[model samples]
Target: MGVQTNPCLVVLAAYSLILIQANITPVLAHVINQTESPATAAPQAPPPVAPVAPVRSAMQPLQATDLLTADKPCSHGLERQMPYFGMGAPGPSGSAGIPGLPGAGGAQGARGERGDRGEPGLSGFPGSKGDKGDIGAVGPQGLVGLEGLNGTKGVKGEPGRDYTPPSMSAFHVGQSSNLQVTSGSQIISFNAQYINIGDDMSQHTGVFTCRIPGLYYFTYTFRAYSHGSYGLNIDLLVNNVVKSQIYMTAMSKHLMQTQSTIVTLRVGDDVWLKANANTYINGDDEMNVFSGYLINAI
Candidate 1:
């Protein structure tokens, strides 16, 4: 018969159809690589959606004539009018606000505009020294000076008014004669008289006269003796001039002499005591003598 089929059921139905195509082959190759790629692959931006608040319908409270007709102005664009409420342009100036509280001090302002001129200062130091005062008062008186010089020359005076003082006075004479003669001049005459007080003395001629008128003072004394070779002399006159003298030679064998004088008489002066020319004389009882006195009356 042509009819006999069972080869083991045809090898177990082809082994289960190859295990069902190996388990569907990666899901059909991922759906065929997603339907053949590129439909311009750049279309995936759909995730930021947060805008949902616009459902408003509840604000209706206005009356003051509806805010004065809502201060109108917006007519043509949306075409229905009257519902304005404006007041907006002032908003940008608000950032400077927090400073307010300092206002009440205004009235002292009007005196200000005069200020520019300063720079030039530095130089100071020097002061120290004081102390010393007190002393004043005393003045006035001065003027006068000059004058001096002249002196010398003096001496000699005494004899004033009409002078007159004198009392004549006199003395004359010899005693004891041994009058050897060998002479040529003689005036030895005295017959012995002692004092002639104002009789002014004149023993014959051994004179002594002066009657007052000046200064007078006279005196004389003498004695002599010489023999073999013989020589002797004596004299003492005044008015007949020969004031005084006495001598002895032959080797002087005993001779003696004395004399004195001061004369200025003028009323008839005359005093004497003479002998000379081979003269010789020897007397004793008071020797040969003559004297006179009267001093001062000129």
Candidate 2:
């Protein structure tokens, strides 16, 4: 049996062994479909993956869904994570941030309960009663009403100089005994009371110039007859100026008088005579100077 093999070379050796088993059956099924499957053990092909930058654990807190989880890393990725979408509904609530500094003074708030009486103001109409005061003056005629006494025997009046006759009257008008004054100037001298004109009108020196102009109560009598004499720049001239000046006294023949000034005269007021005749001394006497009024303050 071993001597026959040439039936066309045994069909070309079984068609070249079926064309090399059909090219080794697709190279053994492409090595069994690139072969790692003995219960799935050959997929170790994931080593070229280098985009992993999300390992933040400095004591961990990175969970915004683990920042786009892919084991957290598309190079810090939750799809490049920054999409919180939460600001749209809160736009109307942002106007209250300026009140933080007044918090330290808040412990005194418990005293408020007394306010319920405010509704009664409309009834005013009655005020008019005041007028009754004047009825008082009928009393003067009762000393038992009468006069009965006549037992006569008296007449001894005349004792030289106990003088007191001046309800008011005086005058002086230059027959010059001294008159020359000028310093805050004022000069008015008069002396007169002549109903009987006797002692040369009793010590003569009277000039009566202003006849009638209403108010005229005045008096200025001055005399400093020696020792550094000074008194009488007599100022009480109503319309010719200088209304008040008559003060003199380092006196000698001393006759300083002034205090009855109530003037209002106006009609060429020429109250004359002012003497500072350097302290006049020819028998010291700025001779009885006078001016008067007060027949009732004028």
Candidate 3:
């Protein structure tokens, strides 16, 4: 009876030993109570609550090369290569570009080679005479400065001479020295015992004829009282050179003695009084001319 011989291998060995005792001892008792049962599994629905998508504050970009590196990318707020920044984004529109063609005028620049004249700068040390300038506002007196050009006249002074004529003719008679004659021998007179017999007389002349030209002084006289008593010859010819000459000689007692010639004649002169007789005496005979004449003219 082998139990009905293999009866389904004993019900498949008792269903494999009850599924190895219900799944290997509950998978070794869940690996020995996985750290003591971390709160029993199947209530994990908290993980599906992942919809918190609002944490987005990432707009800090702009880094042209490595400008301090803070992530990078900004377009409307402009920073791709950096030239525009914007609140309204309307800021950077400035580059128009084209219309270019006018360029040929550039060649005139080559004339600069003459520069070596710089070494004369050291003569500047004479500057200290400057403080006397403020007196200039009176300028209206300028027309009088043109009168200085006249000076040349001096050399003519040497001529003034002539006055030298006087050789002799002087008369000063205070009276008396008689040559008186009358008794009708043609008018002549003088008699008072023949006054003061001429004393110291002198006369000289070459010509005479100016009857009234004022200022004349002429005189001539001769005397005698004891020399021979008498001899007389008298001559006085003016303008004819005989100025005076007289002589009386010879024991002639005294022939009316008196010899004198004086002249101060001015009005048409031609005086004539001459006596001639060598010797004779006796209170007689002629010899006349007394107080001759005198005519003064201005």
Candidate 4:
């Protein structure tokens, strides 16, 4: 008379005898050898200890069945809880840990705004060519540049011929013993020279100093013989300005006076032939002539 058990069916029969893989010491030694074989006796119900009200399963999957209801025990000794769990049986595999300590490095961002030029990458396999380097040491002579802005003025040249027109100036003179000119104005001495080409005429000062500088052509011829009242003033100075002159007044005899000129000399101009006041001039052969040349040479 003492068996009032019902602690939620004794915790579903002790969780189905701890997932029964059948070794609760061989199921309690076959229930103690069937109660000592006394005709298969049965009087063993002592496992309740009373502390229930905490049933929350339905979290299935760990099966191996049998949640109590053996033979039959109702009304108060309760034995009616069924259906549960299913897959379980996978254990043995542990040992390989201890490797954690590496986390702290994040704060270096903000220099990004130059992207969008990609899509050209697939051509790699060409690297094997290096051996040629030795020639460097020649520098220092470069600081003369700033004179380049004057090139646009060319194309107008062609007018110089094959010529020969200098004609070496000329001269001719005569006057060996100019008869008489009593020093009131003199220099009519042409000590006779025939053609002094660029030995620029000066037979003892009958001057002709125009070493080439333009048209010149002078001529003079004088011879005046007298017996009473006579005159023969001749002049052709050029630098003493009397470019050409001749006067042959005679009240007696021989008279000859010729004058020709076209002078325009420059280079230190100074031509000559002069006799005035008591002028007489009577010489022979080629008379008292003086001539000049160079007609064009400016």
TM-score of each model, paired residue for residue:
0.20, 0.17, 0.18, 0.24
After superposition, the stretches of candidate 4 with alpha carbons farther than 4 Å from their true spots are: 1-27, 32-170, 174-183, 187-193, 196-214, 217-236, 239-271, 275-291
Please give the distance, in angstroms, between residue 87's alpha carbon in candidate 1 and its true position after superposition. Answer: 99
- Where does model 3 exceed 4 Å of error? 1-170, 173-221, 225-230, 241-249, 252-256, 259-294
Q: List per-candidate RMSD values in Å.
A: 39.3, 30.1, 32.6, 19.7
- Per-residue lDDT tens digits for candidate 2, residues 75-124, read 32323322221123334566667666655766889999999999999999
- lDDT values, one for every candidate: 0.63, 0.45, 0.41, 0.72
lDDT of candidate 3 at residue 114, scale 0 to 100? 100
Ranking 1 against 4 by lDDT, winner:
4
Local accuracy of candidate 3 as per-residue lDDT tens digits, 79-125: 22222212344568889999899998998998998987787676766
Each candidate: how many clashes? 0, 12, 15, 1
**For candidate 4, lDDT tens digit of each residue in 134-187?**
999999999999988989989999999999856578888788575676658887
Q: How do these models rank on TM-score, best leading?
A: 4, 1, 3, 2
Model 2 regions lying over 4 Å from their true place: 1-212, 223-225, 228-273, 276-298
**Which order, best to worst by lDDT?**
4, 1, 2, 3
